[model samples]
Target: MERPIGVIDSGVGGLTVLHELKRQLPKEQFIYLGDTLRCPYGSKGEEEVIQYTWEMVNYLMKFDIKMLVIACNTATALVLEQLKQNLPIPVIGVIEPGARAAIKATQSNHVAIIGTENTIHSQAYEHALIRIKPNIDTTAVACPKFVPLIESGNFVLEEAKEIVEESLEFINHYPTIDTLILGCTHYPIIQSLIEEVVGPRVTVLSSAVETGFEVSTLLTFYNLYHANTEEIHEPAIFTTGKLHVFQRLKEDIFQLKNASLKHITLS
Candidate 1:
């Protein structure tokens, strides 16, 4: 069987997750839908996020994807359970994988989680971590500015430094935490800056990497792993907002070539 996996995000942020999925499961095919038209689900109302997420999922279902990955943390936090219950295929979100990885990576029970406003406010990562280990301690910070900086292509500038420093003001007090979870997909772009600010000893984990491992494990358990034939194919990337930016960043920043990205309209 050659069924593809459906990965949807509110914008280019999800590309971080999709990149990991490809690296982990090279044989599997993937269909990525980035709802850039309604980007930044973080600031949106809960009802709006839910509707946009489901619409993206519904659109991807047209491709007959075997599994669905809610690659956006905001979307994952808002709509994961509903999608799991309502959709026929397995639906995996970035939160659980990040929580699991943080638990394992932390030497101290204390861990820090940074994400968008909605994702951090939802307390999804904290809940998942606490559910896994009740005694564990968690500190979550919402860095709303990070997403906008990334979207504007200022991720590497000195402005990003100021924003990162201002955003992580809470980290100064929590010196005990040895692991920091990059809960939002967009955070990976600034992982180096985060690591620099937190010092070398503190481990920075992005959910994208862990989610790929989770996806691989689930596929193995379900026997849905793709068997690659002699020919190789490129994954298709669809962006509802700005296609050129996604394409430029994917090739220049993320180094994801061969995959053709196109502009998509939701309707």
Candidate 2:
């Protein structure tokens, strides 16, 4: 538990990032916290998202974590700069890496982004991409139903496919969008269906995967990489709400084994 990387998200969506992190940095130990009780920060106000994100960060800090990764896009959009300034440890968020990935993958200059209403409304991904490449054209759509569908454990079914198709009809209008950024961490869970609907020619950039790569690079740069060689280190998973749902999703959808869930109150 010494110097573990602390990763927090509004909910299980961050596990997408954490899964990649474990694969990329096999030697490092990690402690992940999901604010599942107050899930879906994407629709919340900026101030509320920031405050809740700070609470998660402060709670994780109590564990003496070496670094923090705010895996929620809403949190990143609302609070990344403030967290970087306020926290002594290095803090990272999902938006920049995802933006950079899209910038790299887009051959046509036209890119599409899908996320929660607030994330799309905030235009964080748009700003990040344009900041990196001013000429790039961006189209961001709010796929608010995607998160609820995934959380409800209904994303893999036929109805979910219909919803995915219906939701992506706008993509047909912009056939030039060769690259699509999955702005919400949760979107990656149903990425295959999305890809299928959008067709294979469009490259889907997963913020979760890109964020993991960023975390790995940052860990190397900071030299705070945990070299815990122990074959088994106790990695803790805590949820602010809905333990059974979290457990079922982790095991069934996320394929995360060997992690225990603890219920917590984030007052």
lDDT of each: 0.87, 0.85
Question: What number of backbone clashes does candidate 2 have, counting pairs of residues 3 or more apart or in separate chains?
Answer: 1
Backbone clash count for every predicted candidate, in the order shown: 0, 1
Residue lDDT tens for model 2, 173-233: 9979999999988888888899999998799889877788888788789877666666645
TM-scores for every predicted model = 0.96, 0.94
Query: Residue by residue across 63-181, what tens digits does model 1's lDDT show?
Result: 98999999999999999999999998999999999999999999889999998889989999999999999999899988888887887776888888998989987888987888999
Q: Which candidate comes out best when scored by TM-score? A: 1
Per-candidate Cα RMSD to the true structure, in Å, reads 1.2, 1.6
- TM-score of model 1 relative to the true fold? 0.96
Candidate 2 lDDT at 22 equals: 75
